[model samples]
Target: MAELESPKMMPKSITFLSSLLQRVADSNDLHREFQPQKISVFHGLTRPTISIQSYLERIFKYANCSPSCFVVAYVYLDRFAQRQPSLPINSLNVHRLLITSVLVSAKFMDDMYYNNAYYARVGGISTIEMNYLEVDFLFGLGFNLNVTPNTFHTYCSYLQREMMQQPSLNLAESSLNLGRSLKVHLCFNEDETSHQQQQLAV
Candidate 1:
């Protein structure tokens, strides 16, 4: 199995949400160079109208999951990318990739999570597609879902540092505001989220 990983990186104080957003934005920035055929072969679509930020916001609003799940999802995406370079993140496949990663992360990290059908509805994909994505993602990941405490802490600390270095921006403000409204907590302070996760892990 591939080793567990974290987001390619951000400063120490970077909120997991912001780091994840930056990661997707970086992928989208490089989307132009990706071959269309590669995306279509996996996602069955060649273009995504919805932005990664907006789609992640939707998941946060509806999934009502812990913020840690997003960090784990980012890790899963990194693993997926490392394991399957041919299916790199691009405009066409990123949405589906995000959805699948988050779903898998939630299942692996959270005890109470929506099932595949529910995730499909949330992701705007068919149940069949969601199931297929889940299977494919698991295979691609070599089913390495166990993230150690040290690795998890490493990711959290990295994200926190990144948050510290980044300047406040409208996107961060709006995203945090929306996250607050949705009651989907994005922990700028890692302590609370890490505590909860540790409790759950026990």
Candidate 2:
């Protein structure tokens, strides 16, 4: 496993959600990147090999939450780390913060079936702290919670629809290949485009 960045990074965070509020009031800056219609969203960062680049990413592997939650959680975590670097936190506290952040984001962004009250009750944190964390998270993500992306289910849906038309491609490995092919098929002769292709190809 790749070593994770230490929780000490929390202190290095930018900590000014209030100051940057004007820059991303609606967080349109972040939403411009999320494309829900695409297929095989994280093909390069396959579930089996994703690194702990973000607290949410690290916890999702351990928590078994849905992809929507992961997406919200990751952006929130990154934005928080980006903004408030002085907050004192260890790995455990960071995970707790991420869990609270994920639940809060999910509630706003998706149909999270889990009960927020139940999670907070079970979580070993004060309700006040949870509320504070949520506030920080909202400010970090520029108060924007809507995060949609191309998902595995979308890819499966595309494969099924295509298979119905062709009636020949097997849904086993061939479907996987189709997903891979779709990603690899994008021509990227430019340096920046090539770099993006490489990142997604990981």
Candidate 3:
């Protein structure tokens, strides 16, 4: 559909987008050195709120996933779909987008693709097709698929650690805390720094 022209010129979404991001950084207890381009925005007309991924998230939500992964995939696909030669083509399959997005995210974040069966072995789904989906997945993310929730998690962990002097707890809390700390390492950029530096930063 055509965007209806309003009575007068309206402020660009970027203006408000910048303010929203500033608020986010403030909420996360981070410095304001970040800019809007340093972040990404989710786009529209995605799979309805009542979708398969939504149901799965309700049942079993991973801290690094469930919500974050699905939201990221939705945004990436929307960005690409809008850039297409056509407006609202609706050519991409939502299920395929979700599957491949999660798969790509797995590779980017944790180096885990435990769903190899779903990608390459399930019901005669060939390995070649899985490879195709991988490339397509990258394409959907505008060929800049470096994002992973782990990155966000890493930042959050560092802040929490800095805020506390000595957070004391028992065995279970230790385990949970360790798991949570590991989640923070998700933001470390392998390409930008030595894996050792990632350890030092987080």
Candidate 4:
């Protein structure tokens, strides 16, 4: 089999993307950064009510696409942001961009998957709106959706490292929280209580 090609990157493109994500997460006042003239007037009207993390989590839970599709979607998002500086990943456009990127990624990576209308339902948008967003997102990405296994692994590893570096809840705090939650289940029989605890562990 022929080797797959990877997208080119600058010296600090990944770092830049990471910082940009931190900025987005740290601040919600994006409307001030970008002028109304820069974005589609309609996007201002169609701003997402939910956080980007929540929206992406919803897609991951329902889309049923390969895990790699998410990594590819991230790549596509980065490319789109780089190419279209004016349309930053702000509150107004993140949800649409997320849906379009994930849809395109699933189409590119999965041999069998849902159609646009199905994805539209998953994304809480109309079929017509989903179609329009897909087209505009593709153009913004310059239709460069190809992602090699190497690039995918690189991104995945980068994300994993970032996750590992973040501070986690200590065992004492976790145990205290778990103990509080288990107090509510004292009424159940032993077997039922054990089963419920198992489910909670999962």
Candidate 5:
């Protein structure tokens, strides 16, 4: 497999994405405080000391995935939240969710990506736990890993719009509506590795 040739430095869009996700996760955590959702494999025993932005920056620095993977990872996160109401993005699970989503996105969307072991080290989890997280996340998403060009562009546009209208952006409201209209195709054969890598035009 050919290595991805993108620059290793974090992109500006990643900073925006991190901020947006942090806000969403924080909002969800506050809401779940009273409701108390069920804890699953994604949830950590305790919230990581590191902030979401810093964790994401760490992944960007080491994962070597293209910036587009972050957008697709966001898409996967939306789908997971929609599919699995029990496992919403909150303070406890947001970091793990971000790492797994980005790892899956890189595997599916990039021509080259690090293995689960490498991703595990980057995510501050054991390889065994990372494998479990990957499987659970895939099932949570119903194996809908493929993102259409339209869906990708829609998310990109949404992130860009949020960047411009940060003050007025209602994180919860916007997050709830994201990917609602975008169609996703499911892939059932997990062993089938062939994927057409699409270049994100954003």
Candidate 6:
């Protein structure tokens, strides 16, 4: 239930994720220039004028999902990349991919979320296109949306480790600890689910 807009979550976490994704997308786009790949539904005719960081910040501002959804969305992106190696994350596709992945993440991880049409508006795409992207994205992953606690922790740790490698970011120790804290929260939710089941039996 932790909002990404909270003062404690702002700037650092968002900046770290945006920078990380930008670096990946830029590198992939450069590689694709030399070695062309098959285009997927996620691709756009032209690269978005908006930067990855700004796009992510916009999503954070409006999506109203918990901070944890970003982490989960990153996991989904990685999974999709691994599953669909032919369609890599590049400049042309990254924006659409990001919007779809984050939207899917919010739907799966958060109890309260907006419809695809709302997310499509936030992503600057037509609702019809958003619907197409959602269906295609789900199939691309073969509907593997579940993230185990261990997988979640591993991704969180990987992201933190990547951030640590860049001293220029000057990320605080507390900020780095956010991943572990989120993992703990996930585990608590599992316990809560079990408690709900017990109450139902009573």
Whose lDDT is greatest here?
5
Cα lDDT of model 4 by residue, 117-171, tens digit: 9888888888999999989888988998876555565666656654556334232
Model 2's lDDT to the true fold?
0.40
**Pairs clashing in candidate 5?**
none
Q: Candidates' lDDT values, in order?
A: 0.64, 0.40, 0.38, 0.61, 0.77, 0.74
Ranking by TM-score: 5, 6, 1, 4, 2, 3
Badly placed stretches (over 4 Å) of model 2 are 1-65, 148-202
TM-score of each: 0.67, 0.38, 0.36, 0.66, 0.80, 0.77
Candidate 6, 100-196: lDDT as tens digits = 9999999999999999988998899999999999999999889999987756666676667666776343222332354321011122233454466
Per-candidate Cα RMSD to the true structure, in Å, reads 12.2, 18.0, 17.1, 17.9, 7.7, 9.4
Model 3: weakest 10-residue lDDT segment is: 35-44
Model 6 segments more than 4 A misplaced: 1-11, 167-202
Model 3 ranges with Cα > 4 A deviation: 1-67, 85-92, 120-125, 148-202
Residue 198, candidate 1: how far off, in angstroms? 18
Write the candidate numbers in order of decreasing lDDT: 5, 6, 1, 4, 2, 3
Misplaced by over 4 Å in model 1 are 1-37, 40-44, 167-202
**Superposed Cα deviation of residue 139, candidate 6 (Å):** 0.5
Backbone clash numbers for all candidates listed: 13, 9, 6, 0, 0, 0
Candidate 3, lDDT over the whole model? 0.38
lDDT of 1 by residue, 40-133 (tens): 3346445667766667776776675677887788777766765675665655677787888889999988989988988888888889999999
Q: What residue pairs clash in candidate 6, if any at all?
A: none
